[model samples]
Target: MSSSIWSSLPFVAIWSVGYWAVHVPHLLFLSLRNTIKPLRPVPQWSYRLSMGTAVLRAVFRYIGALRYQQPLQLTPGRSGDRFVRIAPPADANLFRGVFGAPSAMAKPAPVSAVWSPAPVVAPSSSHPSDGRRRKVVIYAAGGAFVTGFDPEMSSRFTSALVTSEHFGATNLLFVQYRLATRADPFPGGVLDLFTAYQHVLGLGVAPADIVLIGDSAGGNLVLALLRRRAGLLALGRNNSRSGGQDRALAHQPVRHHGRAGSVLGVDAYRPKGKALTQEEEGYISPMDHPFRLETPLYIEAGGAEGLLESIVTFAGQMADVKGNRVQFHITEDMPHDFFVAYPFIGAKKESCEALKRAKLFLEG
Candidate 1:
């Protein structure tokens, strides 16, 4: 009826629409939370909590009222061996309206007990030879327990030695291990790693001539296996020779190359034996495993990553070992997984340099 009332009608309509846009997702999240009530406790709850937090943050951000900054610091009293739980980024608006309502929680399915063989890319004949066959290098990828191992993130590091300029003559193998959410923690992935290593060794690669490469979590695995080898040696349980019937096979060293190198992708939190409930940290942490051999090691980490503390601790332990040759490379201002971010950040130059350094370390 009145012109003023008519003009005000549009403003009210816009406000109503915007309000629902912000609140509807929150309502759906509440419904999802209810759905998770009957499921067995699994790490999947972590994923749900993360999603919920993201959605809530988005609603606040959309309203121009959310002000939260995730502290980059690690939790106090935690050891460097434990995995860090990072709070989502402060600007959580990125997840708004992106997810659907959580359905009935899926029944906890039995995780496969069988270990699958690690994927091996066939060696190309074009691989140059340095008079003698170059030693093979196996790479394990690092995804802070959740991400990575897809075609893009893994292919580069797995194929680096064979595909890249440095050490292209050398054979390379990429071992894909189970991530945190998919399987029971700790030895689950480690056991898979052992199986893969054994498989590779069975394929005629000499333990003395093989080199292992891993970054971040994969780095942790490399150290874990080495420690297991030492423990086995101490107990005289290094039964690697028992399975081989041939005299030559019986005498082969239990471990390939007798050494391995790891590139530590710094983590934010370090579990000091008691920091977290995760089982992997209990036995596999470099902090808990003493370096027993003169394993030539190359340790590298980005200066800016929060995991530098863990890297430093790992290096210190390795350095204390008698007869160990450990090289530490700390790059300036490179974020976690800088090399893998090459496609998105145009960091190929920096990544190439790091890869070059890594190749040199492995070769030497």
Candidate 2:
């Protein structure tokens, strides 16, 4: 071998070791988590190919954390572009427990940043009621339910959504949800999502008019929320079909923390299931909760993501159910969270195509 090739052997060896160091544990952890067969089986080749993208994402995330370290902090007393709108008090309990440190680290309140287009108002037709024309997008960040929200990341995504042709200049709420670990567990993140959804509804935006967009874990939350919504709607429909007696019973008023659970009936989406595995994870399957309704859902996934299997299966499940206006796109060769990184990276063609599809979905 050449002298240079021999000299570079140490570097190559170290790189290979580091690559496996990062990937092996992650893949193994996923394996352990899926001892009870995942909703969709992830093939071996797919896992191997996705590791490259995962490594790239990790490198970018670590570098970006150091670069945009200040904006990533959720400290208090900050105003202007740095501040976040807090969540309501009713949902504050969702962050309690052992893994609550992440939530408490923030301003002792649930908060999120809002983005709206500047210098232009969306068309009047966008808003369904009150003659005030506006479009609302409630977005959640994806970090495998372990990493908390990043301000800079949310800002980039919200910007892409707002500037898109289909969504012109619109109102966007970037929700910050609690992350789960072994200490925290599941459903806490899902509960935070429910709170965020309710917060958006409280902001006077109709549920039908609001669009839910999330990526990866955030996408999972969107699916879960849609499932819950579907369940509630189906329950309501079934009740109505069964002689309208239930609607009268629902009106009889049951108190929940001092307010009726629902004016009409029980909202199945209100986080009833106590166990995380049964309530949240179980409903993630589209076969169980295919969001078969008129809600306009736009889901974008990278063709090269580790989560692609589950995302594709969930999307396919929804597709198979019929009655859903769902626009699903897999940006070929892209990795997870490509939308946020597109500006920093130079995959303008693929990224732009994904965003274009998003715009078309919204416009349609």
Candidate 3:
């Protein structure tokens, strides 16, 4: 029988405690192993930071499985990138949140990225104040499509991109979609994002000036939205969009496919141990079909990433498409969505460098 997220609360609580108790040994092993790996040396705290994120992620997915109409505290303020109610433009969709982490805002000209109580309005296709052609980044946050990573993490990502002078982005429109659990399946969530792409077009932002950006599963969604004709930049799943983790086998999160199955949001399209329905299998292995992605792409993964091989394959295939301009970036020793986890692990220097490289991609 199906259960709403409300019914899953006790499990979330118990599992969090239980998982952490046993996760300590694996955490210690990873820390020691990571030390000898060829990846850049950051603070050792990153091991805990990554594991804690994984635990919180599992819990968030459980919470996100509730029906959309449920009485839950999932407003944008509480949502952490999980929700932003998008009604008709005339109804004035309510979106409220400040952009950028305090650390991000501390940089030069962070004001360019900060806003609150901002409505989803028809933005000028160019900077009205300066008459510069607008470059809009349609940002899709990554979280296995159940929950978002966190507000601060997303804000920091936005801050990094927006503050980049090289990228020259005038405005960024974050996409809102019914998550996998709420939408109840694959294309359902993708459909909502397709509408978001249309929304940007309606705002008079030309397809050429628009850039699509996503991390993790969100990256997969960006690739799907490419049929809409926007420039694409993503931290892709190995064939999975922002898969959160790789196939761990007995291991935890060893592989990320934009790919979640044994755990997390996979419960939506795939029930445990059951054969995937046609729709579910299609989503699980998207590259199985051919897509003519004419939009320019900047695909990336961490050198130490579990999703590395798949990401490489996906990017390679995209490059094979006639006239596809693809740029693949590999950040040495980084983990999946390292930029999102960097701040937590005190990797500010690396994060800034990443932003600079992303600027080059956007500018190209």
The estimated TM-scores of all candidates read: 0.51, 0.58, 0.63
Clash count, candidate 1: 11
Worst 10 residues of 3 by lDDT: 243-252
**Could you tell me the TM-score of candidate 2?**
0.58
Candidate 2 residue pairs in clash (backbone atoms < 3 Å): none
- Mind sharing the TM-score for model 3? 0.63
Measured with C-alpha atoms, the lDDT of residue 301 in candidate 2 is: 70
Candidate 2 regions off by >4 Å? 1-55, 58-82, 89-111, 114-132, 235-279, 284-291, 307-309
RMSD of candidates 1 onward, in order: 19.6, 14.6, 11.8
What Cα-based lDDT does every candidate model obtain? Answer: 0.44, 0.49, 0.49
- The parts of candidate 3 lying over 4 Å away from their true place are 1-84, 88-120, 123-132, 150-153, 228-263, 270-284
TM-score-wise, the better of 2 and 3 is 3
lDDT for 58 in candidate 3 is 47
Give the number of the best model, judged by TM-score: 3
lDDT per residue for candidate 1 within 20-115, as digits (tens), equals: 786787667654654664441222333343344345434434322211111222332221221122222232221111011122111112121111
lDDT computed for candidate 1? 0.44
